[model samples]
Target chain A: MSAQDLDGGSDAEADGSGEMPKPHTIRLELADEPGQLLAALAPISDNGGNLLSIFHERGNLTPRGHIPVEVDLECPPDRFERIVDALRDAGVNVIRAGAEHFGEEVMVILVGDTVDSDLSDTLHRIESSADATLQDLSLSAREGTDEASSARLRLAVRSGRVDETLAVVRDLAAEKGLHVVEPLAEGSQ
Target chain B: MSLRLAVLGAGAVGGSVLDLAGDYGHDVVAFADSSSSAVDPAGLDPSAVHDRKERDGVVGDADPESVFDADYDVLVEATPTTLGDAEPGFSHVERALADDRHVVLANKGPVAERYADLRALEAESEGTVQFEAAVGGAIPILSTISDLGAPHVTAARGVLNGTANFILSRMAAEGLDYEHVLAEAQDLGVAEADPTFDVDGIDAALKFVILANVLSDGETEYALDDAEVEGIRNVPGTALDLAAEDGRTVRLIGEATADGVRVAPRLIPQGSALSVTGTQNIVQLETKHAGQLNISGRGAGGPETATAVLSDVSRLE
Candidate 1:
């Protein structure tokens, strides 16, 4: 998983790095089909991730016409990073990942030419580099064109790691010439 | 292979159902009661299914919790009746249905009261709500006659309440009056402390409502207050004497008529199926295309009703 490439996939095979249990969560979308769920599970299970529980809503349809699945799994500390990397390589959307110890709750918004700029790349950068979790997302492509559409991402990030998350979002928006709309911090609020 | 099992409400019917469903190699989930006496034994093993006092899969610690919110594919509603008190017992069933869980209910009072609401909910969730034990005790009435559009049953009636019919049957056979027969039934625990629903036509009337709603493909609304009810309160010499001329016996017939459903005595044919339905027994179902379909068997005992429910549960897959 490169810190630069945005399409998330880094490899295609199980170079098993394994995982240790941590309290991290990720949200993802996949095409609805028989093997999609199994493919998603592979990244966690093959990497030595301990499955706590899985909430598979087969009936609830996601935006991509797929079922929404929430999996809570445990991974070992030693192989956690490699497990995440393997997940990215397998083309499993590593929407969010962290070694159970990192990440806390945070809310942020960026203003810019979101549609014109590659917003998907920006989100991937934050996850791969900033140690934050995208908890929930609300997007408005109201301007309709890909160049001007904007999206709001609600994230669960490592506690005290909000600055790192914001830094990535800020830098990406600046590079794409998009505006940033962020929340108030310590004294500002 | 083996599976998990649980029995909620360890009363007469629940006890019986647990015994039967457990017979097949399923590990008992736990025996549960409203008060739940078996909460201390952690992880009640599957072997407990055979314990005469033990029930598998109830709401206690030693038992598997009936977590209505969690993902369990099946539920069986076997509870005693509370004619109008629509809480925990029957309402627990409502929760099960809401979660889209499969259900087989032996309890009739709740269906009599909440069938329409539950049916709509099931339809919305795309789940199944079956009640084979509601009306005809051990009789397979619900499955036998489910053509709610009336192509199957243009008109139908039943000798529904077996307990009441049993009491009436004894009076006709022994040539006794109401007091002696009532005393005999009470000693046998056939009637309840408040005998209004069973005798005053409320019980049979509610069954009447269930039949009418299912047969008409309508809703569950018992304008029961409007129904003309005539319970056997006293024995009259002329009534007993009427038997001499009619050559026919008396029985409680819950009839769904053209104008409205009614429960009363009608002179049935001498060798009619319903007339031969005997003590604590039932025979009543008629289909238009299929003609008359008579189902007769023990209609009121707990074990029989339990077997009725478990039979449906086993056949679900």
Candidate 2:
């Protein structure tokens, strides 16, 4: 696949295909070489990743004396993981790889019958729903699966999609008979 | 770099590949059908050979034997599926692999009937074998599980045969008998006139064998006979009706585990993953890390099967 500089603004909004291209930033520690930056960018472009920008820190160096470069690219959700995989396969050292603007994260608590009702499937449904991705998950079932228990989930949603993502989670929780403890808005004094 | 290809069997599957290979950056340098064959070091005109076959039942002036010496990087085997010894197809693959040329198979015969022998051939040969189209026409079933890594994939189950699944689904939804549905499926070109391989579960069993072997990671060798096969021929409409009463649908599911492989009609709960209708085929992989990944799509079609073959060609190193 060839990469095109995805025309115009944020590709995060759904294209006519009904699938959004998420913009992601990848931080990499590259050895100081003539074509190291070029080598790293090849994989991103080859695996259907659209080049957005490159923040090549030629003036600075990391502790190990390697230049740290951050690449900004956009690709469909399905293609993002593959670009990362291809980059790694090409021997690029990735420091951080994720969405650049999942600007909001919410921690929701679920209580009652998490395990017996299939918690894994519920989480799977939320992620596959495409509005958000699960950032972290923690479950506390001290008593037992049969008894009431609570699970914590940190969901990373697009900047403007926090409410929509939460609504999906709430609906899924309601169907499973789980109580939702919504995370309060930031800085409530 | 564009790879040169020599396609054997020149039927629908092979013809589609011959017709569509150029769009995917593959050049068909040579091709062979039953009666005649053609070869060119640069590239063959796909339309020219197709027209020849349509008019004269042959592809070219050259004999079929010339395919062995054709100048190509990958040899595509798209012959008919044969059981037991897996004749001409096996010989075709053996010849290609022995020459250290990569092979892509849409034919189920060599892989199903003689997996052990084929594996042995692949072990010594410099070339590799890819058969994604053999199991599911357009769905990347084998490549998906294989790319997920064999260790991660624990089990695989799916609705593999479109014909059998179509027959069974229509019987349930229409409340029709097996014979009536089978006839309807045949009329719709979903089932072949000689539908024994599909209805008797041999086709599904062959796919399960391929899946089992792929999941085994070369540790286990599974032949067509290794699977305990049961077709949907005896599946009565009454059984489907009884299943429907309980909010279930009967589907012919092919399952492969580390222990064994089998194909039989099983009742799945409504809205379940395997409850696909018509000619859709689905394969669900049970993985250790990731959850079940279900891939469903057209199981068999000329262009679809050719696309799988071309995808394999593209992945050939």
Each prediction's TM-score against the native?
A: 0.54, 0.62
lDDT: worst 10-residue window of model 1 chain A: A4-13
Measured with C-alpha atoms, the lDDT of residue B285 in candidate 1 is 56
- What is the RMSD of candidate 1? 31.0
Quality of candidate 1 docking, DockQ:
0.00
Winning model by TM-score? 2
lDDT of 1 by residue, A19-43 (tens): 3234444455566777887788787
- Candidate 2 lDDT over A103-142, as tens digits, reads 7776665656543346656765675564565665555543
Report the lDDT of model 1 for residue B217.
67
Worst 10 residues of 1 chain B by lDDT: B37-46
Off by over 4 Å in 1: A1-189, B1-6, B24-28, B37-71, B147-150, B219-228, B234-237
Candidate 1 DockQ category?
A: incorrect
True contacts kept of 1: 0.00
Candidate 2 chain B weakest ten by summed lDDT: B237-246
Per-residue lDDT tens digits of candidate 2, residues B1-317?
A: 79999999888899999999999988999899987899998899999998989988899999988988888899999989898889999999999999999999999988888888998999999999999999899999988987899889998888899999999888888977778888898899899999999999999999989889888877888888889787876566655654565466667788889778977666566677788999999988889999788999999989999999999999994
Backbone collision tally, model 1: 35
- List each candidate's DockQ score: 0.00, 0.01
